[model samples]
Target: MSVDRDTVLKIARLSRIKLEDERVEPLMGELNNILAWVEQLDGVDTTDVAPMTSAVETSLAWREDQVSDGECAEDVLKNAPVSEYGFFAVPKVIE
Candidate 1:
């Protein structure tokens, strides 16, 4: 794959960046070099390689699923400026 000057200009326009006429050639050269480097990866043989989700091999340590409240309602309500019943009270927002 190769990037031409026109392609570079199109990319700049799509990204909402202003590319000066003199800078287009330099950007085009850079894009072409990046594309060539990426193309080189296609030559690597991966037929026998197994797919992997992470570079480091390790099993996740998971805990048993459970549901429980903090059981400290009185302790938490003490910090509220104005608590009503068992909940925090705030200014009425609607008419």
Candidate 2:
């Protein structure tokens, strides 16, 4: 697949990029080159290859599923400018 002039402009608008008229042609060529390289990758044989999530094989460590407060509420409240009833206190913003 290749990108045309209109596609480049549409991409710029979708991305909120302020692309100049002079830059559209160059950007179109760059995008087309990228798509062409990706298309070339589709020609490779991956039938025997196994899908992998990471370059280096590793397993996550098992852990017990438990929930508990971090037990640092007092420590955390010390940093607050104003705290009350075991919680941070802020000025009321609405009536």
Candidate 3:
């Protein structure tokens, strides 16, 4: 993609970056060079390669699926400033 000065200015505006006028020409040249390099990568062969998450091979360690209360109610309610009926009490906010 040919990144012109006008296109660079639009890109800067959209990205919310306050770029100086002198920087636009250099930035446009750099962006065009990057696009050209990426275009060159499209010709490489990778038909047999599988997609991978990491360069090194590894497996995730998963624990058993268990369902239970995290802790007894007594332990959780002990730290409350004001607890009633095994629940935290707060000042009334509604009229």
Q: Tens digit of lDDT per residue, candidate 3, span 13-80?
A: 99999998889988988999999988987798879987778877888889788975677889999999
Runs off by more than 4 Å, candidate 1: 46-95
Residue-level lDDT for 37 in candidate 1 = 87
Q: Runs in model 3 with CA error above 4 Å?
A: 60-95
Models 1 onward score TM values of 0.46, 0.50, 0.47
Model 2 clash pairs are none
- Inter-residue clash pairs, candidate 3: none
lDDT of 1 at 48: 92
Each candidate: what lDDT?
Answer: 0.89, 0.90, 0.89
Query: Where is model 1 poorest over a 10-residue stretch in terms of lDDT?
Result: 62-71
Best prediction by TM-score: 2
| Local accuracy of candidate 2 as per-residue lDDT tens digits, 2-52 | 789999989899999999899999999988988887898788999989887
- What is candidate 1's lDDT per residue for 54-86, written digit by digit as tens? 988899988778856688989999999999999
Better of 1 and 3 by lDDT: 1
